[model samples]
Target chain A: MSDLDLLKYTCGRTDLSLICDLIDPGSSVLDLGCGDGLFLRYLKERKNVRSLGLEISAEKIASCIANGVPVIQGDLDSRMEFAADGDFDYVILSRTLQEVRHPENLLDEIVRVGKQAIVSFINFGYFEYRFELFFCGRMPRGRHLPYEWFNTPNIHLGTLTDFHTLCRERHIRIVSAEPLGRIHGILPKWCWPNLFAHSCVFVLEKEK
Target chain B: MLLIEPQNYDFGPGEENALELDCRKKLYEVTLRYETCGKLNADRSNAVLIEHALSGDAHVTGYHTPEDRKPGWWAEMVGPGKAIDTDRYFVICSNILGGCSGSTGPRSIDPATGKPYNMNFPVITIADMVRAQKRLIDHLGISKLLAVVGGSMGGMQVLQWMIDYPDSVAAAVPIATTAQNSAQNIAFNWVGREAIISDPKFDGGNYDPENPPGKGLSTARMLAHITYLSDETMGRKFGRNLQENDHYAFDFRRDFAVESYLQHQGRRFVERFDANSYCYITRAIDYFDLADRTNGDLAAAFHSAKGKFLVVSFSSDWLFPTKQARALVKALLANHLETNFCEIQSGYGHDAFLLEIDTLGAMVGAFLANTLNEVSSGKQRGAQS
Candidate 1:
């Protein structure tokens, strides 16, 4: 894909701004499920962050390597063998946590290797998705959840509250969190987005 | 640019004390020493500084010291008609600042304190090492360099030189190196450091002068050596092959040929290299974050670099892999810099840049000749004008 197209697919609008604010220049970063590695390349070019990407698709890894973003092809469900403990300053799991088979294990691994972890996922508890399931009696499909129910990779659908509860149970402290939607552009904080927004983004730190 | 035959003259072989140069605050009054293989002239444009890898020394393509039986580490690449083409380029290779050669290192006495610096030496970064080289370049009265070239740690210096002094070099070739150290790499370095510190003889990086921490250092080298080779290369070369007989000897008595090879490498390395130098140099590699130096922009690092680049990488160099080389190319391309890259297929691992004889030689010689021709013709046109 072209650089512009890839950037649009990877960063969207909200994710890019969030990544910019969270990632420090020169920080060693690990990007899990780094689709096309657009975000990592952007960070590397603009911020000087040393980024390594982990993606399951060989085609995506090839694109990443061609762009000079280091990437390894491997399943996230398996143990991460390439990185050691406390290797990166941040581990990003953008739009990927719900797709994995065992997100808890992956989260644990992310915490083990990085000081902070940033997770962004489509919140199934969003009002439209809930309404579609309750009244329409069909799985919701839209800009955020674009995949069909039968072929979707997202197996572990979770809500904002479920994610926060999981983080608490794992003793991972939520450093910051934001709910994202079209309305967030006007009122980002006042939009009680757990049941209204399309997605949720969170930054968690493992307690020392 | 002056072009001279490679074997025309000699750099004074006498053991002169390390001379200090007045480089700006970026560097200290470090020793600058060099051995030359060709005529020394005022233009100094023919001079090529050969940065050595970690654990390498000033002897680029010559006999090893004391035990002169073995040839230099890069004899295959640095001699006449070799990849580096010493015949056309007046090659100058020095042991780095935190090195164990005749240069000042951890073992060298601190003139002010009258004691070996050891672990007490200030933690050095890759830029600091390049700054020392810059001082040496100034001491030689060289206005600019033909090229700065090396592999692994040497490659790190090449990158640092281009970024730190963009105007000083005409071309740069850094092989088998990444834009910065990876997490896996940091872990390996940490393990090596831990191995050195945990040794009983270490004494907290201040071992006795008479009996250094050879065991710990040897182990560290052994561990690092494994990463330097590819699985395919090792499998083809050694692969289930016993030391001598087909059966296993069971006990840890160098049963495998690979084990014997590693043991010999470790033993020979300890004799010439200092443990503290290893610690310091590895630390420098760890701190090598190119983005950090350029205010986090990879493209910005090359914004002022007017030099042409020919970055070569080997397919099987897992340590610093071809992917890393491509990253550098991407940044250079982003900055609209003149560049050429070739990921030559080879199973020699990170050492492929050194061992892929004919391929590396042809690529480097052709690139150098083309750049030199352009430079010479430009000068001729200027003269006419």
Candidate 2:
């Protein structure tokens, strides 16, 4: 079965392997916003990726240890001063975009640390979200976007289109991009990709 | 269970293996007491060095004897299945050169005079202590170490190990220690030192063989104990509660529970520890500043470090606070080293490294285990290439 087909049937978001597939075997990787470090271990097992993770909380760090993951306790918003430029083959910011304090600075740092990057985020401009705002006159709430407005970790939520614009303005190239969730591949051309995709993933590299 | 007596590595007879000090002197004929748990592997790559803090002896785990009910200092966390599991790694803990516990120190007899070195013992520094540990590591026939784990002064030694022998260690765990002792730290040491020297019986580090400086030594221990604990922790354990009575005693006797506790700690410490050794070790710790060698360039110290680093700090450890760990982390990062830092949520002050067994063990175990896995895999990859 296709990756999307398998995800559609699965109960939880247990599919960072889709991003793991993008990494070359035996390459180095760094995962920012690594919670519990399961994705890091997944990369290690499947891709032979010599990976490390950066997490902030002590509880998460303890859990990372419990799982035997080599994770560092640190914040992405802080200068990742330890990581040198082009240190890793890929730096994955999976599903952690809106949670960042500064998306622009974070993307810059990702490109600085990794030769390439894989970014995944919830698309606030999705059709379901817009429909909720337009018809029900309330903020969107769905399977992926689970938290209330006040309690949401997605402080800087934005659309996939908005991300594309930011990348263009900052001279970073989106090497590849994909839409995700229930009806992503079923949608046709000219059907507004940003407004329909529930979430988005993109491979990014520096222009210069 | 019981543990074997710690084996001694005798340098023997008048400065034969003289160790140079940071203060521009050399210690003549020093001996180090060390104990090993777990057998060394065929490849000898599984050796892990455990450095002890001030007042800690060579025994890190297991009991001295069946009659001695208390196990070694870190027994709770360094056993067969413990965090620093003895079954997998060859663990070695040594009494530092300047330490009195079976190691050549102020208490050791001077070969020339046939009397205790006492005040005549050359001043030693933290770097000197690490150098002595290195000598012990060499004597054991291990070319490299998998990791060096320590807390406080022991932690200071770990940092020195990383800097001093950059390529020798594979990884390091420096818990509850700083690259440089703060002014406040020095001040606390000063107070502790003053208490010892002020006693009339101290007699400039020489003393009556029978009387010694028991009062002074205990008072010094009492002073040092306060710095090891946080105000909140002290309050929780003792507060302003009176000893055996609700009413305050107006006399000079130990009235408050805290006062009694401090006195008890002081009394117990003198029985096991040497007063002159206390003076020397504290001096050594105060002199420790890794950045000094590189003219205040902290990153330069770790520039040649080949080891992955794990730096841990406790929340309430104001003695070696989280900020100090962060500063050290920044330096390690500046050198492009693989370093992980965790400021654990705790309220036990500097003593948390010794008390918080579960968290400390798990993190050290995982970090060391993962390091071994990665190193072996890298070796295999190299062979394939």
- Top TM-score model: 2
Candidate 2: list runs displaced more than 4 Å: A1-28, A42-50, A63-69, A77-90, A100-118, A133-138, A148-151, A161-177, A184-190, A202-208, B12-16, B372-385
Instruction: Please give me the DockQ of candidate 2 compared with the native complex.
Output: 0.46
Q: Per-residue lDDT tens digits of candidate 1, residues A136-186?
A: 999988777788999998889999888889988888888888778765432
Q: Give per-residue lDDT, candidate 1, residue A153.
A: 86
Interface RMSD of 1: 11.0
Tell me how much of the true interface, by contacts, candidate 1 captures. Answer: 0.00
TM-score of chain B, candidates 1 onward in order: 0.88, 0.96
lDDT of model 2, residue B300: 86
Docking class of 2: acceptable
RMSD of each: 13.2, 3.9
Cα lDDT tens digits for candidate 2, A1-208 = 3445444533355326457667899998889978887777666766778777889898788777656666777887887876778988899998887888888999999988989998987788988999999999988999888988899988998998899999998889999876665543423435676888777678999998
lDDT for model 2, please.
0.83
